[model samples]
Target: MQTQKIDFAAVQQAFLAAGFDLVGVTDCSPLTGARLARWLARGYAADMEWIGRSFRSRVDPRRLLPGCRSIVVAAAAYEPGRPPTDSSPGKYAVIASYALGPDYHRILRRRCREAVTQLQRTSGQPQKFRIAVDSGPVLEQEIAVRVGLGVIGRNSLLLTPSFGSYVLLAEVLMDTWVKTPEQKPPSRHICLDCRKCVQACPTHALTEEGLVDSRRCISYLTIEHRGPIPEPLRPLLGTHVFGCDICQEVCPANRVRSAPRAPFLPGSPAESRYPSFQELLRMSPEEFKEKFRGTPVARTGYQRFMRNVCVAAGNSGDRSLKPLLESLLSRRGDDPLIREHAEWALEILG
Candidate 1:
């Protein structure tokens, strides 16, 4: 029987139809698993032990789905906007642009599944496939580079000429192989000359080798790192309560002219831009859930989030919020971390 050929154009259309902004295909191959294992062994992954635990599966796509042959990599661009940084020392907070919307995991999974369904039916290929966004043990950036999508930037983010690093990457592993377009070798170190991202890191979290030390990354500190932020790093966090975007903002490559609206962040930009310190300090767990429901902010929960708020309050130099911070410090049953940070904020205000 003559084998029917896969039309790559049709596949591209399928992905675009499903709303993916960027798409590419590559052979399923072993990524830098050994290097990742070494990094994990060195404890660079910080408290994210899950990355080490899933090391084997993340390195080899075949382990994820037996007989996996080709990887269909996709990128969904998130709109880039400068987070409001208040130099006025007022009560303001900054949040990562990605988290200012619905969780990318849910959005990308739904969108990728829709695209995969279209690919199967339209291309007349085997339906055996697996979808993964950030949740899965997949080296999405590596796959993306293999497929000629982009190169790893100095900030350790996949950088595309068109989208820069403001994209959420996802992948679909399939059992069937498809002929992908030829491309030049990926420029892994795209920012060799430019060190803006490195210089912009307030905490020097980025290394000279272009890797992130999550221990000092404000994004990691504010979001992933639980408990009272180390006193030394508290002032460095500035007014960022959730995540930091200073590195991206300083990257010349990220100065893209414009971008289409990110589908996940549906509300008015102001609505999710920055949470006021007063509001966050007083927000109950249920209130936090209701206000940030389906958004990444909810993942931090009230206590940890308030912990971040206290740090931002301390950095804000906004004496007006002292009463609110004082209330939190006196409130019984408050997490000690929150109380500790509140006390620090009081000291800063004084």
Candidate 2:
């Protein structure tokens, strides 16, 4: 007689039991395989080429964690108790909603680990198990989409019906061959005829098809890319000093959704929602690091981050900022990219 199979429901139940608002599982094969190939073929990932490089491990969860037979996808809502109000003018340092609270990677990974532990308690330990929260070689959104957690938005964000795009994607790869639930497909989005995102992008980064050209993406220039930001793009960057949500901001889908206070996220800002640019320009690297230690702004580093601050200052034309911009204008940064941007900011302010 064959040994009895462990219940897949027990594993699914474990994640929900452990506080994951969303959880679903999928067989470790083809659907994931094909999507990975498609994303790589388009070459839309830009400098994040690593995404394409880790193809096999991303598709075959078992390659990364041997004996893995089932993959679990989980999401946690973080809709912000109250999102940033409409106006925080003068080059505000707007952070992406996902980064405001404690790092979601840590939060989600711990939750996934807990769920795995609970699964182990009930489903029995096996050869191996692992969890990835945008931390490793998994195609998170693609997996989420294939696993039936959410629909892939034209913007490339995973949009869940109940939560919209405010949820973070996280996953678990386990050794046992647990059964998976068929994922419900995402609903048709309202972005059908509206080209709001493409039309609204200051730099035209959002291609007509919704694929963002990273070189033109303000968020990529200010946050992801190293060295100075491109000059022509400076003025168009607007006031966003860290991450930008312009596309989401203009998106009708994002406008009237009923998500939670985004409790999984930080509460409303005590004093202010968006960070003031002038304060950022003057902050020492050490000071900046401490302030945003794990926050999204910290990802940009000191010098590059300040370069953005300076640009925002120049654009504000507050007159009070002349002394500050003058200070940055004097010191030539080591990187031409940074210097090129500073020079452009001065031109804009002039």
- Candidate 2: what lDDT? 0.69
Worst 10-residue stretch by lDDT in candidate 2? Answer: 80-89
TM-score of 1: 0.92
lDDT of 2 by residue, 1-350 (tens): 34334566787677777667777777677344564565456765657787777887776676888766777888877664344465546646556656666777777778888887876676575447788887799877777777677676666667777777777777887766665555676666646777877888888877655466777887788788776666667778877676677787676667666555225566747223476667766666678788878766676777787777777776676666666666655654555654666666677777
Task: State every prediction's TM-score relative to the real structure.
Answer: 0.92, 0.87
User: All models: lDDT?
Assistant: 0.79, 0.69
lDDT of 1: 0.79
RMSD of 2: 3.0
Q: TM-score: which candidate is best?
A: 1
